[model samples]
Target: MEVKLHDIGEGMTEGDIISYLVKEGDRVSVDQPLVEVQTEKMVAELTSPANGTVKEILIDVGKTITVGTTILTIASEQGADPAPAKEETAATVAPAAPSQKSMIMERPKGAPLSNRVKAAPYTRKVAREHDVDITLVEGTGRAGRITVEDVLRYVEERDNGKTKAAAAPEKTPSVEKEPVHQPEEEFDTIPFKGRRKQIAMKMSQSLFTIPHVCHYEEIDMTELLDFRKELKAMDENISVAAFFIKALAIALKEYPVFNAKLDEENEVIRLEKSVHMGIAADAEEGLIVPVVRDADKKSLRAIHQEMKELTQKAKENKLTVKEITGSTFTISNVGPMGSIGATPIINYPETGLMAFHKTKKMPVVNEHDEIVIRSMMNVTMTFDHRVADGGTAIAFTNRFKSLIENPKKLMLELV
Candidate 1:
């Protein structure tokens, strides 16, 4: 029978063939990883449907195939020889390695956190980092469960407090003052699943796939700060992030490649016609970037509304699959979190990303000797070196900074 492959998720109608693990004429058993697919969400491994010999392999690597596409053909050996089939039935199949289940766990669909194991997420994390086997630890909590204290105790006893005590020669570090035991109660740890997993994968892909060039510049935002205050006084709901988004859209009109993506396979560069801007939101999970499509045409109120809606959707886990994909460019703002400046990872496929940090009032000396306190914010723009040079990237950032500092320039009289 022909083995037809179907999309494993709702929004995924097709996927780019990452690679085929098994080749034609290769013997394969049931449930072995046969192929891998790159969908919008995550890399999914397609396993063998039955115990059979590979007859034919269809489709090439990097080809985008749709649902119900024939990935490969497998010929069942059972009916070929009745004696072999009977022998196979009587043969005992050794159980899979016991360590497999510990490495992989089922994540509940939709809700990323519901179906995970009972241990605190951070405790599991600590064990993994220290190379301590979590399965071996005894539990003192209810239901014979492992707790954070249990994991910490394991670490302390295993290391004999050598590293912790070595850090300070004055006295043995008080167990009461163990640094890792900080006020974790302040934050709820959300499972890194769904969009969060996609975010992490993309971030790592960006770092590994592209050569990044981070160009930094400090801009005087005195006028912009006053203008922002004026706008806020007129309407308190107007956000600085919205203003930054608008300024970024204006700058993209001047520097196009900063809003471009590399089509490496086809040796083509794609400059997006419409600016779909993304605002980074750090929710209970990790950072999520939800795009605002056709942002150049949206009014300030429209921008604010879209941003508010996306933020709400991100927090409530109500964002549709489409909301997480497709972006010409992205921006990460940590001003709300009080971060001054940070070098951010570019969201992959997008050639560039800009990060906005907290604005601080600092004393500055003008072209004249007059010293005055001016409001300034640090802007760090990271670009893919393969697409844009340092000069082009810097020019893009400076233009963006100018629009932000003037604010009225972004509000040009005639649209």
Candidate 2:
């Protein structure tokens, strides 16, 4: 059976071969991870479809392949003779006709996973002594030489920094315990087609496709902070981001235009009812946004718990396609990251995005006109101009600020 690269989601056309979880000649069970692939959105594992021996690996690490491209050939062990002096028929030997032979020649069978290696006599001796598989050890020495140190370090880190090979444990028959693809050595130029490439494509699309208008506002976060502190004191814990999400949901409900997509092809702005808020997170790979589904209907605690779980999943690169898609609105809480202000790009197809900047104590005039210290945060609301006007953006932000400033009111809106 041939194992082909399948589409994960979001119209994924291609993926980079990260590593083979099960090595060639190893046995793999059904659903056992066969290989690790780096897709545009996330790193995913392709599993074995049946119990078999990994007959051949057609693709190599770092090679990019498209969907339906065969990457591995597995020989199924189910209902087959273990000891083969098994008879080979004429069909198995070669094509019967000229036309069929030509068709077989046209198809490219990717190079087998088994590859040749180069090493010095001393390095070879060291590798053999340590029982390290020299063929799997990538060389870092001059002219791609497999050095002794490289072999030792691979043994040491056989487990740490498990980006590629870590997904498969020792219990799995397929994993060969090779080091995951780690960019250990410095390079003058790097391949530009992983998470970085995806971000570039999406950002360029959003910028060129949508006319962005940014509105800035300074919010007094003193009330919200105090409210949170009081809640913490009373053992009622909730994150400020959750409150922000809830308030954004309420404001989105009021200003339904902001929670909309301008369907240019359809020539109408489609306003969405359910609020799926995408929480932008900074993971090890790049910027990831995991959606908080139905933020409008969830309470502060529920939002907080879900946001915490989503954040963890995003950081770990374990978020499913459903968890990252169908977001009607998005928010980038850069306050913790110490960003003062930024005109964040709208998560394409969504009309607006909110970015919260660092909050700090600043002197402000109270209603009585006396100077008082307040926690102030800068926020920028970026919207697609074709879908909404500046007045509407201002009104939307004002409503959001009103809800954030008066926690009691925000809670009332929530209930």
Candidate 3:
């Protein structure tokens, strides 16, 4: 049986082979990962079609292959004598001689296979990159397949061991060394591919095509902070950003223009009925946004949980195409990284992007004219000026600020 590249997702016509998980002569169970491929949107692992020994790998690492192309060949018979590892690379392997009583099992189309590890291809790559043996890492994914999180846990434990070893007293005395400097600067050039390339293209298009205008505001988050504390006391694992997302979603109802895509080609604004909030997450590969669908309908706890899962998937490079697309509005939060503020570029097509900065304690005059310390956070809204005027953007931010300051309004219906 041959394992050909299948349609991984919509609009995915081709993918570059990042690496091969199984080499020729290696025995692979049905649905076990065979190769890792990098598509335009994400990196995914192709799996074996049947339980067999890999007879030949037709694609090489870094080679881009079209959909339906034969990726590898397998001798599908169970309990057959395993072939020895081949030293020479070949494009094709000769088929085994015909036998009247061949015990090869035929897999039915679209039928679920049992005893297969369920994991994405990128998860396997993470294990390989961290030098963690995935077989030893227990999976938290569907079934018993190892996940990137499992591999990360193993690496963290292994690193802690190394740290403890380094902390032990050394027998030899430490020697002081003189500093050395190179006269010429040197750097390695990595080719722009996969996520990096997609980011560059989209950013360029958004910047050049959209006429952007930014509105900056600061919010007194003392109440929201107190609210979050109360929620935390109840053992709810919610984030301040979740409240912000909820506030933004509610505010978007009043300002539908913000939660819209500008179709410049058609000269019209398409308002999204359901709020799909894209959360900007910085991953190892690059920056990616995984959207939370129907964000307006979800509670703060639900939003936080979804964001946590999506962010984890993003970091592990396990985000599917649907997870990364169809966002009506986006929030880029740099507060965790201690950024004071940033003027984020609009995510393409979406009319606006909300940027959140670090929250800090600052003295401010209250309504009673008394100076008091409070938690303050900066927010910047970057929007398409053509789709929304400056006044409208400011109005949207004001409504969002009111919701944040009030805290309870976020849970109330817009009406």
Candidate 4:
């Protein structure tokens, strides 16, 4: 059976082969990861569909191939003789001396061959911008492939003179000190591919297609903080973001327009039956939002657990297609990163996005007219003006704010 590259969802048409987990002649189980492919949104592990013995690998690592292309040939039965490796063709003899370019291309004695340098196209680009020879930098990825981090680490070491000292350096001509000022100007160029490209496209579309209206509110989280501490004492590791998600879910129920999607072609507002909350998590590749399905139906602890699992999977580049899609509403919490506030763009197809910043202690007048120190947090909501009016947006944010500010009321409703 031929193991073709199947669609990994999100309308992805192609993927770059990151690395192969199994080699020819290796037996694989059904659903076992066969290879890691870098798609537009994430690096996903393409799995074997059936139990089989790997026969032939059609695609090489770092090669971008279209979907439905056969990547591997597998024998359905075991003990099949593996196909022989392709023979290399004899090199044609060239006349006399090599050209200037060919001479410069020669690897240093004892250095790794350029053709053997295992690096992604983006990693190679970074190497070029820094003038760092990738063949000299050791690869740290699977199968000794060079990753972005490895290239960056090499650049750092070279800049710090650690790696340079280990290798022979080119001689520089001595010049007398004459107050010559040469400021060092350096920058890295990151190729917009994979997840970063997807993020850029979606963000641009959301900003242009949706008429956005932002509503800002500040909530006192002192009570919420106390409640979290109490929960923590009980060994419940629920976070403040979970509480905010719950409050947003409740508010969405009250204001259905905010929980709806706009069908511009049909000119209709489709209210979602269930609240699926997307948590915008910053992963290594880029920003990815993994959704929590039926968030309104789950308890705060359940939500927290799911959030942790999804976040971990996202960061580890293990998120499934179902986990990263289908959110009616999304929340981006920059609070942990020490951001005070942010006007986040709406996640495309979703009508609203909620952004919250770091909580800080400040003096505020209490209901009893006494000035008291309290933990305050800023919350911003960016909504589609087409799907919801300004009044509806304001009401929704106010309801959300009210729930967050009154922790007891919010907890009682949960009960």
Candidate 5:
């Protein structure tokens, strides 16, 4: 049975082979972890498909390969035979201690990789550090590729080429010279390929594809704050962002256009009934959005609890693919993080994203025309102008504001 890298989720096109948990000639059970693969979003373990003994290890570690690429082959326990191995050449070596199989390094569709590189850059760097010729070293890694370990071993053997040099005369010791000092590097380089790269690509595509128009609104949070204070006195401490999500869900029901996807290929604006709210979270890896599935159906308390758990998981890089996908709309509660205002990029394919800024005590003209100190917050609604007009966004913001300003109104809309 050929074990290929299958699509896990989120339509991931490629993945990096982080490491192999099993080597050739090792017996593996069904669903046993065989390799740890890192996708664009998260790290996942690809398990064995059948009860089999691994026959051939194909790809090398740290290489990002496309989906459907045959990574390895297995000899199933149901009397299946291993595939024919390539005839070993002078450069070939066993994949494992007990296996006669050798590794084959190639890209998808059986296209051979270039033969120019004997070793990777880091491998050659190791040989250079020891003043060893990399071209003279033998390769033991996949497809006769030299690895760091191979270079180190060669250096050791070369240095210990017999304690006695067969009666060769010892040379006189030269005077010790002062060691030269080199200035330390003043810069550090961070890898830009994983989550950070994903964010950049996603944002760029969203920004360039959709014509974004940002709408701003000032909301009176005085009533909501007083209501929350009363709840706090009764020890009912719910997150303010949870309330925002609940109110946004209610608003989405009335104006469902914002909760939609613009499929240009079909030339239709698809409106979603279920409000899967994506909560923008800052994780150690990068920005991640964990979805609250069916926010419209969930109660405020349940939404709050799930949102809290998902945020924690996202921060710890433990979120599953389902928890991070299928968002109909997104929300960034930057209030706690002290953001004044921001035109957030729409979570692409989704028509819109709402950002809640800091709530502060500001003087405002009230309904009675008296300047009063009220807790006010600014909300920025970023949407695809092609899908919805500014007037529609303003109306949507006003509807959301009315619900949040009057907590009782928001409670009445709860299912």
Candidate 6:
């Protein structure tokens, strides 16, 4: 039987073979990962269709091939195995078939006694680690909910041997035999594809291939906040986040080393002139980093317009291939998520990434020794230590700090 490579979606015409999880002649089971393919935007794994001996892998790494192309051949005994199922093309999953009016959606079975426990994903993961029947753990959350913390506490108790059965002095005999049941929560599982897959591959590569160093700086954004307020009053659509990107662009101009790319093949660093900045936007589907070309040369309005258009297009799933490619530096701002700080992974080929975190109102003393409530944001930059030094990263951050603290300086730079 031949296994054809089907498009998994995200507008990819072809995929570059990343690596094969299985080899020719290896017996594989259904749902087993067979190979990983890298599209320009992300990576995706193709799984085996049936239990069969691999006959051949027609595709090789770094080779780009079109969709519906036959990439592998497998040998299966007739009537011995069911035909492995293939996923429908990268388009949306076909909607569920209409059920008869009399049909009832039967929930999946869980804990022995009750059919109504709901747990979060993290909580379920924690329960599995502790070997605890989640359905049996009494939920303290609203409407009988199980939180991640609840599961963690249960694990800690078990680790401490604090169970009544373990610490009790009197032994009791079992009276009646009954099945122990736990309630299971309903969850929608999303497959990793497109940008999610690219993030994973780039993270793995950065961890293994590059020696990375992260430096942290807490920026006093009191001035920046005031500037943002003024800007918002003037034009509400221009986000403070876009201003942050402008700051980063100016910073790159001064610290060119931080903007350079690591040539892994040549073991050298190459500094380029054009500053293409990647703004990481969280869309309903996944994380997309759309680049702003020549950001330093463009006016604040142009940058804001481009960022807005790119983000909107990204959300609408209408970004062209050209819009998402060729970024020199990347910024992932999770401030909207309320994260205080994070050391983000460097997007490969590019040596640095800056993660902007939530701003908080904190008490601070100025040089005048006066206590004041000020807005503070933490900016963390992760760089490939092989190419850039601590001084380079710090300088880049300092320039960013200056631009953000004084937004008017950006207009001057633009002219």
Cα lDDT of model 4 by residue, 335-408, tens digit: 88999977789988899999999899999998999999999998888999888878888888888888888888
lDDT tens readout by residue for model 2, 1-415: 8888987866465678998888889988999999988886788899999998988787899886667778888889864323323224323554449886676567554322234465555456556756767877877854465655677676666646542355655664575687779778866986677777667656755765689999999999999999999999999999999999999999999999999988776789999989999999999888988999999999999999999999999988998888988899999999998999898999988999999999999999999999999999999999999999999999999999999999999877766
Q: Rank order by TM-score, top first?
A: 5, 2, 4, 3, 6, 1
List, residue by residue over 1-415, the lDDT tens digit for candidate 3: 7677777764344577899988999988988988998876678888887888888787788876656777878888765434434422223434534561242235453233333444455555556766765655666743455655566676887877743346667788778889788698788999866767556646755775688888999999999889888888988757888888988988998899999987755877899899999998998888888999999888887888999999999888889878988899999999889999877999887899999999999999999999999999999999999898999999999999999999877667532
TM-score of 3: 0.64
> Clash pairs of candidate 4?
none
- lDDT values for all models: 0.73, 0.83, 0.79, 0.81, 0.83, 0.74
The 10 consecutive residues of candidate 1 with the worst lDDT sum are 81-90
RMSD of each: 15.2, 16.5, 18.0, 11.9, 13.8, 15.8
TM-score of each: 0.57, 0.70, 0.64, 0.67, 0.74, 0.57
Colliding residue pairs in candidate 3: 45-121
The CA lDDT at 377 in model 3 is: 94
Model 6 TM-score (2 dp): 0.57
Error of 1 at 388 (Å): 0.1
Off by over 4 Å in 1: 1-197
Clashing pairs in 2: 22-174
| CA displacement after TM-score superposition, residue 149 of candidate 3 (Å) | 36
User: Which lDDT tens digits does candidate 5 get at residues 47-86?
Assistant: 8889989998888997866677778888999977657555
Evaluated with TM-score, which candidate comes out highest? 5
- C-alpha RMSD (angstroms) for model 5: 13.8
Task: Please identify which of the two predictions, 2 or 4, would achieve the higher lDDT against the true structure.
Answer: 2
**Which 10-residue window in model 4 sums to the lowest lDDT?**
87-96
For 368-388, candidate 6 gives per-residue lDDT tens digits of 999999988988999989888
